[model samples]
Target: MPARTQLSALRTFRPSKRLKVSAVALTAAGATTALALAGTATQSTSALPAIDVAKVTAGSQAGTKVEGLTQGVADKAYPAYVGKPTAAAAKNTSRDLTKAPAKAKPAAAAEHKAKPAANRSTVRKPVAVSAPKYADNLDGWIRESLAIMKAKGIPGSYSGLHRNIIRESSGNPNAVNDWDINAINGIPSKGLLQVIQPTFDTYHVAGTANHLTDPVANITAAANYAAHRYGSIDNVNSAY
Candidate 1:
């Protein structure tokens, strides 16, 4: 047989085998192209040609005829060629999901809780104070009486009260005038200032003990009487 005649005979009988071989070769080429494109996925897609996965997959499956595959068919066949995510992108997403949120400091939270409110009102308890102490003598009594007299608005001096007290009772708080005219009538004059019970009761200052012989009470009442009768005890030098 001639070589040309033998080749024609092979072409007629083994057409299906040739078609299958060509389809397989085309599928492998397309896959290689896809892999090369995937290696440079991070680069500009504007410069790269769009792949036709539909035609490749159709050629592989039919082995009889190959045609342009639709977008839907291409998506099902080669997902990597249609916006497939990279490993770095997937890793970044996983890192973001696993990251922990920032927490508030314990010390700052405690300090905020411990702080006092600005609008809160506070109350204070009253303190008790005792009266001032004085010595147990004539001078002490006079000084104490002067303080009381000043508070009561009665006018008298220390020298005037002291002088009258000495002249009347010789500084004796328990002095009495039993032989006087007032004593004859049963109302005897008594105390440091020789004040009778009626006179003492009439001019007795409040807050003092209501006893004629009580030095402070006696002085205060007598001074008060002297202030009324002669303007002040300082104005009276002798018996009036």
Candidate 2:
């Protein structure tokens, strides 16, 4: 061949088998590098310690337990967070409600029993009072006159007879009203009760003395005359 044709052939000449061998070697090198890196990562992860989840939960057997926590911390914190009352306090309140009430006296009875005596405004005397007394001589004459007047169905008291005798005779047994109206009519009054002759004879008690100056006889006759004129000698306070 000429020199120029030989140079062209050399430029176009390819080593096909050697090229295939180099490509195959490069693929094998890359595959070997990837496998080495994967083995190194797996061995490093397996060398660390393992964790047991069951043993951590088994420490708390009574109440619920959180992960990585003990029972002591949960027991102390449960009461502070939950403020509801317990069963024992509710039972004590129920016992107190079941007890009986105490007995007591009424307010009106206490007030009535404790009232003071000074508060009573209408108190009164418990016994009756008696009339006044007179002298012995005058008392005897008046009492005797009252007895005779009573027998004749006439009404008179010792107090009434004594009062009239004091006004008429001034307690004199032989008193005479000679200057008064009875004397002006020619009939005068005499004795303790001061009876005139006509009045003495007209109203004389049957069993008594028959003189105007006799004390008991004069008193009885005068009371009888007074009873005939007025209602009774007790009703007469002035001269008849």
Indicate which candidate wins on lDDT: 1
Alpha-carbon deviation at 219 in model 2, angstroms: 0.4
Worst 10 residues of 2 by lDDT: 75-84
Task: State the TM-score for model 2.
Answer: 0.42
Q: TM-score for all predictions?
A: 0.54, 0.42
User: Per-residue lDDT for 146-181 in model 2, tens only?
Assistant: 777877898888888888999989999888888988
Q: After superposition, how far is residue 47 of candidate 2 from its true place, in Å?
A: 99
Q: Which segments of model 2 are wrong by more than 4 Å? A: 1-136
Candidate 1 per-residue lDDT over residues 1-79, each given as its tens digit? 4556544644444224544565456666785543334333323333333455565455444542333445455555555
Query: On a 0 to 100 scale, what is the lDDT of residue 144 in model 1?
Result: 93
For candidate 1, the C-alpha RMSD (Å) to the true structure equals 14.0
In model 1, residue pairs whose N, Cα or C atoms come closer than 3 Å (at least 3 residues apart or on different chains), thus clashing, are none
lDDT of 2 at 82: 30
